[model samples]
Target: MIMTKELWEGNAAIAEAAICAGVEAFFGYPITPQTEVLEHFSKRLPEEGRVFLQAESEVASINMVYGAACAGARVMTSSSSPGVSLMQEGISYIACSEVPAVVTNIMRGGPGLGNVQPAQGDYFQAVKSAGHGDYHMIALAASSVQEAIDLMVLAFDLADKYRTVVIFIADGAIGQMMEPAEMPPLRPVRPPEERVAWALTGAKGREHNIITSLYLGAENLEQVNLRLQAKLKKIAANEVRWQEYSTEDADFLLVAFGTVGRICQTVVREARAQGMKVGLVRPITLWPFPSARIAELAGRVKGILTVEMNAGQMVEDVRLAVEGACPVRFYGRMGGVIPLPDDILPELDKLDAGVASGREVQS
Candidate 1:
């Protein structure tokens, strides 16, 4: 197949990628920095005879996604930070019910109703706890338009494979930025016969399969929790993914994800140009968190700096992974601020200075 590269805005590229991945249904509401995803689906999905509905609100959209997912349809939704927060209850329901669904979050600034500027403030919400549950969803973070497209496809596959919700997360910058990206060849939606055995399809010759997150009995819920925990363990073991840049020999390591991770790559190069041994480790799978790799690098690198667009969420995870093997510091810009290489280099310099002085690197 001759795959042609085309320029696309981040949000539109994600919507197109979902279509190429055989999304049978898309339910979403309009929201800044991510509304394009819903708009794109509105036009394209209908042309292809797929389901596309702009629900009344994010709550309605996610519930619609839950219903479609229960029927084993490849369903998806897109939203920004506050919009995603509105869908949390439904997201948690999808989690415990063990339904495969895809959710794309083009994260914007917020603790609540923050601006539409790009921000990674949703890191904790995306990676730590999607909703009020002990369950986990596979979270994939993208740093570029091309990666956003690629991970959108991966999100659907992983969602089906694990029978869990998968979140394709990126800062708003990635959603609005336009870049050349090679889309995957279009794939056909799975046939109804290919749907999972547990789908809520009409019962015929086989025993009816019941799926629900509500287990009123305490003991019954415990068993369900145990099963979910086991599944999470399996995912963490098998799905940890990260990229290492110039880590072959380094005195310092820069750890980040999404847009900040992309910036840190430039930080590594610029620092190296000045004869500093700096490297970067960018986590792609945020939940199955590449912790083991960071732990190993911690033992070798003199210090690690975690740069983020949040106050400092992922840094906690980084600190945990390091386990005091070395000093772990944090630098961040909140409320839709994008941290440039220039802003990050000085932080790296401080880390270097602290390490050289044998002083503790403050986070």
Candidate 2:
């Protein structure tokens, strides 16, 4: 299959990816930095006889997704920081109910109603707890328009494989930035009988399959939690994905993900040009974080610097990975600010200076 590469905004690539991946329904409401996703689905889905609804609100939208998912449909929703917050309760329910749905968060700055500009402030809210629950979802981060498209397909597959919600998270910069990307051929829609074994279809010859998060009895609830925990473990073991750049032999390591990881890539090259041994480890799966890789690098590198668009969220995870094997420092720019190589180089320099002076690196 020949895929013609064309220029596309990040949001457009994501929307197109879902369409090509055979998503039958989209339940979304508009929010800045992510509104284009809803706009695209609204215009394009009708041409394919698919469903796209601009629900009254995010709350209603997520619930709509839940209904679609239970019926064995490929359903999805897109939202920004505040909007995703509202969708969490619904998301948690989806996870516990074992529904396969693809969701996207084109994250932005947040506290209450934070600005709509690009920021990675939703890191903890997404990776740590997509919603409040004992379950884990397959959380994938995309750093570029192309990766976003690729992961959009993978997110749906993983969702279906595990019968769970999968989140494709990218910061606002990637959502709005324009880049050339290739879209794979449209996938054939799954037949109703073959889509899922336990869809909420009416009882016929087989026993009816019930879908709910509530397991009222104590023993039954504990058993459900145990099964969920086992699934999470399997996902972590098999799905931890990351990319290592120039870390073969380096004195310093830079850890980042999403758009910030892309920035750190340039910093790595520039630092390498200046005869500095700098490398980067970019996590693609944030929930089943590449903890083992970070632990391995911690022993090899003299220090690790975590650069992010938030004050410092992923840094906590990095520190946990390092376990004091080496120092883990943080540098960030919040409220939709994008960090540049210049902004990050100083942090690396401080690590070197700290080493030379035998002093602790100031974050």
Candidate 3:
């Protein structure tokens, strides 16, 4: 029986969003705190005449997604930290093949098999090097269940539009939390037969479409890489997204994304109540990373502080954005630890101290 509850856990909401967005096939293995994504799909997709495969491992799951994607199906896969690590090779193949697929990481803490709690430690993996390639995915980060639903829909369209991978990075907290969300209006899945122009259907009346990542010749491979880089540059120029909160007049800025960005938003409001001139810059799209906006903010603010769930991954990008125009400081809580608003304010406060000293804050 379908649970018609008004409140939805984040994973469940995402699954429903996928169905509404016309996701035709899902290939994934269950991992926590994200198994709910699989659970929801296993029960709901078949009801809508869609396909769901519980693969043997994250490796098998992603390759399966790659195959289905090559067939021009709207496909998806998801996992937590360790599982996501195992799928990197398959991700590389999908990138080079230029297939459209959506991979969501409901992040948990990790070095290997860390823990089943919320953390934003996958920023580097998702943004810096999604796979072993000089390619980029349309990386989107969601703060609330509604945004998660909305982004999942956008993720599919963007993947199909660009013929590239799109990643949705949500932390374990967002994966497991209950929130009221309205599903997007339904859209019908396009028939695979209609995609014969690109899909690998048996050649009957047209040119055989070959979908492989192999390029043995040096010059041919270099040209392919160059075109992919062109696509990435265009995506970066067109898709960089962020929100400026109380930033028009601020002395220090808190730079964050994903879940930390949500917390920092409250820190902005509360800090303003206390008469502190601090603001927040939350990156909405993590890969095309809104760096230009961060750079502009650096010129406007006295200093910037990066808050993360790891020692400091995204801080490197934030520093790159600022380019030493202002000091950038990092404060992190690792291994499944979620930072509170209070935990972040002190870090933003420290940026001023470093600015006052004129000595760069050492990481």
Candidate 4:
């Protein structure tokens, strides 16, 4: 189907994409950099006979999402950093119950209600089982408005495919930035048959299906944990995605994700123009992080540099990906500050010189 292209903020693009993907319910609270998403949905979704609720709190909103998703409906909710933190308990519950839902975290400065602007401080939280107990969430990072739309659709599919919660992670810059977007026609998503088997949609004619994470017996919980581990292994083997630029003959690889990855794209271009064989590795799925791909490149490259808005959360992941194969270093700024491409150039130069100086340190 033909799609019309128009300029839209990332948050608005996500909301529009969700509607096009047949999302029937949205529950969220107002939070900066992400409020535009709920605002757009509130105005547009009802026109399609869908539900949009501006919940009393982030906690209440996430619970509403949990309820709707449990009923076998496509559900979504969004919030900024602090608000996302408030929704953690519900998210954990969703994870434990193995419910399919979309949670968008338009991140800002962290540790507290730090700022209303963009930041990438929640990298670890997004991928590291934020709620609790041997559960994993599928995490997708969007670098542009188009990506926001594209990945939102992918997020819903993955959530259902895995029968787990999924996160669409973008920073404030992506959330607020306006760019050309194509709104694709809606295609019906077949509701998962398992949802009907397990979901609580009233007694009906069959025996009641209970959705709970609580398993009192240690052996039963151990079996569940084993099953989850196997699932994660399958995801790691098949689901990791990343984008590479100018890696054909590069000595240094610059790694970043989300909006920071977009910024690094420009840096990679400039560095190549100045006769530097520098490349970039941008992770698309942060949870099933493209570790094998990164590890494969580590054998061919001289060093890896991780750039982010936060101090060094994602850097740790890069280090793990490389696994002492090469030097991994970090350069970042925190608390709503963004690192400009120009500012990054000097660090690139220093890394180049450090590699040349024959004192390469393994990250």
Candidate 5:
């Protein structure tokens, strides 16, 4: 039976949902705003006979994830911004080996050891290739505790289904928020299937299998690149997810993701109350971004506002989606600062007025 409970923080809800999803292993290090995730798992997974390890460093922890996933176990790890950077090498390794693993990044400010406070600075790193090579992490952004739970569960399934890494991205505000959530029932673990012709279990009477990204010959490397590209095309076709609010009659559209998207929702409501036609496009899948949906809205709305915690990363995608049909603007706060609804209102008003004036306004 499923149980409903209240979790006061988004990280805790994600940990709980992983447990419910029958995640068998978790290996990670501690980091601010994300520490609660490990803490919750440490206390809970043990009683259930699940494996939980606190590795010496982020690098070691992600390597452990790679090792466990090779054995066909459901594995996960989490960190904040800086620690996530440290795990990039292992993430790339996992991608190349085609191992399924879930990684959650409770993002904080940074280029270095910047701040423990929230920021969307890692947008490019997470959705684009973080380590090296042509690879993509299935990136999901959560705006609330419920979304945190829902996406973590989905992340695990997608990782295993696609044989790739999945990233759950949330910021400090969403990680710290309180909400009621329905806890899904624990899933039963199925024993690993017979090793595929490719999986590297033990050789044991079978042809030895190698898990590697190294293709020394140019032709072989080209084939690998082609295969990966095909997989990405399929992912884009099947996995784009988003939320739209008050879009039908909107003259102004807002594009945002993660915690910033939730804030934009409030701004949209306020703008509507003031007799302005405003709407929102919240991208749930950050990697296979909801670009097509944004494009459709471009034909209807007068302008688009791309709000983020970073200076302007997703703004580029919005611009691409809208093409030259509508003006695209950006409003953001960086280095651990949050953009307030009051602060966002003026930008919305300016865009609304610009639409009225017949002058093209882009920010």
Candidate 6:
């Protein structure tokens, strides 16, 4: 099959990629930067005779996804920050139930009703667990439109492979921006006979299948939690994905993800041209973060600078990964403000000076 690159907006690309991945249904509410995802699916899915629902609220949308997932259908939902928060309870239910589902969070700013601008403020909520209880969803962060498209496809596969929730978190910038990208070829929808063994298709020929997050017995709930933990360990061991640039011989490193990660590449290039050795570690998977790689890089670099579009959320993870091997500093622009190369270079300079002067600087 021939593949051609075409200009694509990030939100629309996410919907298109889901369709290409054979998403059987999409249940979503309209939210900025991500409303396009729902709109795209609304038009495309119905045309293809697939489900496209505009639920009254994020609460309704997530539960719809949960029901479809239990039926072993490829299901998804999209929302921004506040809308996602509303779905937390449903998300936890889906996680505990161990059904496969895809959730797309085109993140915006805020602890409350923040603006519909690009921000990584949801980092902690997403990676630490989007809802209550001791459960986690596979979280993937995309830095570009192309990566957003690719990760949407990967999210579905990962969700099915793990039989768990997968959250694809892309900042509002990516959702709003447009770039040239290649959409994956369409995949045929899995027939009922091909659904997973655990699906609730029917119990005619076999024992009934019960899918629920509620384990009323104390021992039963403990066992369920243990199984979830084991699954997370497996995911961490096998799914820690990240990209490194210019680290062969570097005095300093830039650690970031999503839009900030993309911007740091420019900082690395400019810093190199000015005779400063710099490198970057852009994490693709936020949950099973690239901690091991960052630790190794910490051992060799003079210092690490973590840049983010939030008030330094991911920096905490970087600090843990560094483990005092070297000074880890954070620089961030919060409340929907994006940090450009100009905004970040001075922070790197400060980290360099602190390292040179045997001092530590914190963000």
Which pairs of residues clash in candidate 4, taking residues 3 or more apart in a chain or in different chains?
none
Total clashing pairs for each candidate = 0, 0, 0, 0, 0, 0
User: For residues 1-363, what per-residue lDDT tens digits would candidate 4 score against the true structure?
Assistant: 676799998889999999888798899999998999999999988888788999999999999999998888889999998898888899988887788999999999977878888999998889996776777788899998998899998988888788788999999999999999998788664455535567777778888888888889999989888887887788778788889998889888999998889999999999999998899999999999988889999999988989999989888888998899988889999998999899888888888888889776664
Q: Could you estimate the TM-score for every candidate?
A: 0.98, 0.98, 0.96, 0.96, 0.96, 0.98
lDDT of model number 1: 0.93
Candidate 3: residue 6 Cα off by (Å): 3.2
Model 4 bad stretches (over 4 Å)? 188-195
Q: Please give, for residues 1-363, the per-residue lDDT of candidate 1 as tens digits.
A: 999889999999999999999999999999998999999999999999999998999999999999999999999999999999999999999999999999989998888888999999988888887699798889999999999999999999999999999998998899999999999999998898888888988898989888788999999999999999999999999998899999999999999999999999999999999999999999999998999999999999999999999999999999999998999999999998899999999998999899899886544
Q: For model 5, what is the alpha-carbon lDDT of residue 171?
A: 91
Better of 1 and 2 by TM-score: 1
Could you give candidate 5's per-residue lDDT for residues 1-363 as a string of tens digits?
Answer: 546576557778889899988898999999998999999999998988889999999999999999888877889999999899999999988887788899999999887988889899889988996798888999999998888888988999899888889999999777777888777778875455643445666887877777777889999988887887888788889999999999999998999999889999999999999898899999999999898999999998889889999988989888877887899988889988999899999999887777779775654
Give one digit per residue, the lDDT tens place, for model 2 in 1-363.
777899999998899999999999998999999999999999999988899899999999999999999999999999999999999999999989989988899998877788988898888887787678687778899999999999999999899888888988998999999999999899987767775768887788889889999998999999999998999899999989998899999899999999989999999999999899999999999989999999998999889999999999999989888888887888999988899999999999998888678686533
Candidate 2 Cα errors over 4 Å, as ranges: 361-363
Q: What's the C-alpha lDDT at position 157 in model 4?
A: 83
For every candidate in turn, the CA RMSD to the true structure comes to 1.0, 1.3, 2.3, 1.7, 1.6, 1.1
- Predicted model with the maximum lDDT: 6
Please give the lDDT score at residue 314 for candidate 4: 83
Ranking by lDDT: 6, 1, 2, 4, 3, 5
Worst 10 residues of 5 by lDDT: 189-198
Error of 1 at 74 (Å): 0.5
Which consecutive 10 residues in model 2 have the weakest lDDT in total?
Answer: 354-363
